[model samples]
Target: MSAVTIRAARPEDAGTVLELTRALARFIKAEDWFLATLADVERDCFGEAPRYEAWLAEVKGASAGLATLFPTYSTFKAKPCLFVDSLYVDETARGYGVGKVLMRHICQLAVERGCVRVDLNVLNWNPARSFYTGLGMQETGELGMTITGPAMRSLAGLD
Candidate 1:
């Protein structure tokens, strides 16, 4: 395999990113939950005020993987942290270290931005848990939680 190159995704790459996103959803058997559109990707990732940043991995000039992340504050540390929204490698690109390269790129970005930490959540059943552990990531012991859909609306008094 050729050396994988990682680059900040350009607006032109939005479709490729969205395609990989769907592939990831399919891989995780969550196709029904995948709902992002090209417009969403374009606006959120490449707009004037990007909600997040994305990087793409390419091997031999072909798209292979992607990672999306955003910054957040850690009041305790009084510094910024990066939360990885997703890290996915195409099936054809697995075992070629694409995921590891992307993760290292995220960490490198954190360091450059003076971030205190980098965080991400992986499903308990995901085989990538071991991959993260291998990179020295440890379980924080805090349960992940979320509120969405009608429940989210009710919390915001929109019900």
Candidate 2:
């Protein structure tokens, strides 16, 4: 096995990134909601004034995983926070420390950007929880909530 390299994703990596996203969805049994397209990724990840950033993990010159990151503000801390929207290692690459490398890269980036902290969510039933805990990530016990789709429309008085 060749050395693994973690690097910032480029616009051309949209297709591969989308594939990784689908793999993640399937792994979590949420493929039914995986409707995003390559164009959507390109537009959202590399458009003029991109809203998010992504990183790629490559092994032997092949894509192995991806990490999508974005910025979020902390009202109480009054500082910037780095939010990891997703950190997925392909099934073939799971045992090779690929996820850890991606996470460390993200953390280094957060520090460079002057972020106060880095945040990400893991599913309770997912085995990745152990991997996160092994990295010294603590559970703050804060529940993550979402108001999207129909609920979001209703909240906006569009119903």
Candidate 3:
């Protein structure tokens, strides 16, 4: 495996980022939930109002993986944080430290931005939990709660 290079993603890399995202979704058995397309990725990640920033991992000049991050606020800390929206590595590039490089790059960016912390969510059954844990991310001991679809509609008085 070649040395993986991590850098901020450019506009031209949007398509590649989307491809990696789909590949990751498939790897995690959530291909059905993969809803992003090149158009969406380009618009949201590289458009004038860019909703997120991305970092790419290149191995021997080929895209190996990517990590997308969005700005978030920590009410308690009264500071900004980064939410890692997605991190994915190509199947062929897995276990070669591509993900680790991407993660470290993301952490470095967070620190550079003076963020209070970086946060990400992983499926409970995900095998990658160990990897995140090893990176010093502790389990908060609080289950994630959500209200969506009809539940959210009813709560919002829209149903």
Candidate 4:
């Protein structure tokens, strides 16, 4: 196995990030709901006042995985928390410890940033739940709710 190298994603990596993201969405059977574009990736990750940060994992100089995350405040802990928005490893890269490496890198970054914890939402049926649990992540037993599309617009009184 070639050594895996993880690094911060740059503008030129937008396409790679989007490709991996689409693959993930497809894996979860949510491709119909995956509306993100390459432009969105570039803008959100590399634009001024970046809303989030992205990291890429490469094995033998080939893209293997990617992680996108942002920081949030933990009012209860009185410290910041790192929320991993997405973590994915390509099919060809699975079983090679790429996901584990990416996750550990995220945790290391959280520690270096003085974050009190790391957070992420995983689908109930995702088999990766076991992988996450293996990394010491516990299921919160909380339901995730969302209101998007017209409902969100109406809630914001944009209609």
| Best lDDT among the predictions, by candidate number | 1
For all predicted structures, in order, the TM-scores are 0.97, 0.96, 0.93, 0.96
Q: What are the clashing pairs of model 1?
A: none
Order of candidate numbers by lDDT, starting with the best? 1, 4, 2, 3
Model 3 Cα lDDT, one tens digit per residue, 8-102: 88889888888888888887898987889889989999999999988899999988888989999999999899999888888789999998988
State the lDDT of candidate 4 residue by residue for 41-156, as single tens digits. Answer: 88888998889999999999999998999999999999999999989999999999999999999999999999999999999899999999998999888898999999999999
TM value for model 2? 0.96
- Cα error, candidate 4, residue 67 (Å): 0.5
lDDT of 2 by residue, 1-159 (tens): 567899889998999989999999999988998998998899999988888888999999999999999999899999899999888999998899999899889889888988999999988999999999999899999997888898999999999
Model 3 segments beyond 4 Å from truth? none
- Residue pairs in collision within model 3: none
lDDT of 2: 0.91
| lDDT of model 3 at position 141 | 82
lDDT of 1 by residue, 27-139 (tens): 88889999999999999999989999989999999999999999999999999999998899999999999999999999999999999999998888999999999999999
What TM-score would candidate 3 get against the native? 0.93
Report the error of model 2 at residue 127, Å.
0.5
> Which of the predicted structures, 1 or 2, would earn the higher lDDT when compared with the native?
1
Which is better, 1 or 3, measured by TM-score?
1
